[model samples]
Target chain A: MATTACFMIVSRNDIPIYEAEVGTAPKKEDAAHQHQFILHAALDIVQDLAWTTSAMFLKAIDRFNDLAVSVYFIHTRLMLLHDSRNDDGIKTFFQEVHELYIKILLNPLYLPGSRITSSQFDTKVRALARKYL
Target chain B: MAPVAPRSGDVIFASVERVNAELFTLTYGAIVRQLITDLEEVEEVNKQLDQMGYNIGIRLIDEFLAKSNVSRCVDFKETAEVIAKVGFKMFLGVTASVTNWDAEGTCCSLILEDNPLVDFVELPDTCQGLYYCNILSGVVRGALEMVSMKTEVTWLRDMLRGDDAFELQVKLLKQVPEEYPYKDDE
Candidate 1:
């Protein structure tokens, strides 16, 4: 099905801090670009939907054909654009990544709202992606 | 009265007023952020943090002594052990391993597998020259100074810098002749 599991962490101020393309199947360069474009386009919708409820997880908020957008917000918005509808796996992935994100945030050296550029963090997120997503 | 045995860090920590870890962590993060912004240079910020830690260390030694029931003037070897086993545990709730001592017993490394001050930190490339945990070195230096041990402390390894653990190399420079924390006793 050429599955797409592109995940992003956007800071509260609407800056993209971390992004990972964790698709199970191989994806084309153009498809990856288009996926990011769609993900960014959905951020506006996410902001609007975030304040409407106190809940952190908004499952499958906005969908475009086979692509589904799931968001988990806590100071930073964790958005995943995936092709499947596994709510449990997506939620688990979000929660685990949140823990990792907090570790990044807790660093006295890390400036808030800056791009997250750690290879270790990237590698762990990819591994978690394989495990849960 | 028989001399009292020194209290364990766990016992002293249990009696101390401790704040929420997250609150403390975030507050420290904010302070560091403010320091960087105000200083505009990572090196300056590092120095400022060390200075702040030095001030805190000097004052903290009094509370540490009164609470831990550890007598002043322990030898360098015992001082390092107490710092690793009791001092860190009392304040940060984590124990450090003391290793890599010189034969003369003038130097050693305090290895911390877990550092409470460094939970959420990843150093950006711009700040590579900065020692994120420099304050810790200053604290050790300042604390030792009060007890008449002239020492130098440096970061041997930092977990933030991709090291396996946090290690501080503390070197005894020269032992000053016994001084007074006893000025008021007369």
Candidate 2:
């Protein structure tokens, strides 16, 4: 498990649909903003690198000092920033959340390429974070 | 020979020829998107989707009966169960649970935790009033009507609207008795 981790689901239209800060360590006031800033900053690199290869899981693509940014690609981009390095756990987390994302998408009322505001999706993602992250 | 027993939903679904889940999901998403663009109103889009489903249901019921080999269901309770159990399975490849029945057994909720229809959907604020799955209800109503059972179907719980599961309340409004072993039109 990572001492600290931030996860986000970036939609196809380049917006964060769902986000969660799942770190065991107590969070600082500026931590979430910094984490989000770092994650967004790495998107250009991730996107550029992702286009070159079809591989979905690109582990530790960028590092911001002590924290590392990892990413997994499906129709949407699943990105994570964490202090601890646990490749297997993060991959499992992405895969499981992807399944949940699919469930969210199948809802006819839910429009694709929109923000995922479902609290149920939020709760499940957090629970998965606790179990995996 | 006696009527062949209705095949289980699981068996029929497994045998059905279908495309990959992603293709099906994307195609539906495309249709809904096109409707929203063309209709320019969430309510209108919803109504059109329901109408489309109703049309499909009236025609699709025959395929459902033939494929599942379900005999005529006399009671509403039995009908709801078969729909939740077998109809949903053969068509969508997922089984739904029947719950929240009233004392009269004329109404019940079809709870679906998993269905192929809901995947990759997120509702915007403007589309809040939309019943995205309203088509399912229309389909149910239209199909039931064909069997001489006038019914009303509605969404009691919508996962897209932040509920736990998709719950459809199917209420029997009236039942029309069929004239059995009848003569053909002259």
Candidate 3:
């Protein structure tokens, strides 16, 4: 049994949109069946964040790109669900992400590349997952 | 750009600016759409819209600050000038001028030289709501409050009245929150 919880907060609306999953996986395999669920879950999280506020919606464009890369980096063998093979400027996007990551770390309110693990937000996400998928 | 047809009290050469129009339309759409969905009473919808616009005004002050890189206005006239020039020009693409400033200073008139939103659309005779214009009032009140001014916004003409020109009444009152968070401690 493997359970992972993740959560995100929207700054403008002060609302938390979350998604979590609890399922049994034989192992974290390359292109594993459970990994598909995780990718789907992450996409749902990104989509909800987009809908929360106008500011958040604009911010999500950048965050979604970063998250796609992060997921790939975390599971080197798993291709991202949203990866576009034809999407040009992959290298430039990565460079920009690296610069932004540095900026995020410099910000007192945030830490660089830290996975969001707010328990309250995760609880809401898990409840939604249980209800829907 | 060609000069817009001037209203009775409007500032000459009222011009449109893209940034202001984008911010205004987006904010107006967001507030109106939300009110129509989440609220039931017309009065409550109005209240919520005003309040939302107030907060938006507070945030927009920051935006104006960042974009214009200007310090606080020295007085209400200066404040009004910014509202006429930078504020409206930034958001609505129109410049309004003060006319017939009241002795109490609580009542002033704004003549619109041109209005993009009003162009090509006629307000039905039955219509009563202020709609997009109230948001501008909220922005003015909130932004001015940062520099210590208390004001109320009222309309002098209903574009719904089928008038070629538009005007709004701005009533300025005694200052509130005379100092800001960063103000020097006396």
The lDDT per prediction is: 0.84, 0.85, 0.47
Best by DockQ: 1
Instruction: Name the candidate that leads on TM-score.
Output: 1
TM-score of each: 0.83, 0.64, 0.44
Instruction: Give the range of the ten consecutive residues with the poorest summed lDDT in model 2 chain B.
Output: B1-10
lDDT, candidate 1, B65-98, per-residue tens: 8888776545788889889888998988888989
CA RMSD (A), model 3:
17.4
lDDT of 3 by residue, B54-153 (tens): 8888788777666553456666665666677666666565677778776655577777767655432322222235354555567677776766677787
Q: Rank the candidates by TM-score, best first.
A: 1, 2, 3
- Per-candidate fnat, comma-separated: 0.92, 0.54, 0.00
* Lowest lDDT block of 10, candidate 3 chain A: A70-79
Error of 2 at B184 (Å): 14
Q: What is the lDDT for B75 in model 3? A: 67
Report the TM-score of candidate 2, chain A only: 0.93
DockQ of each: 0.63, 0.31, 0.01
2 versus 3: better lDDT goes to: 2
Query: Number of clashes in model 2?
Result: 12
**Candidate 2's TM-score:** 0.64
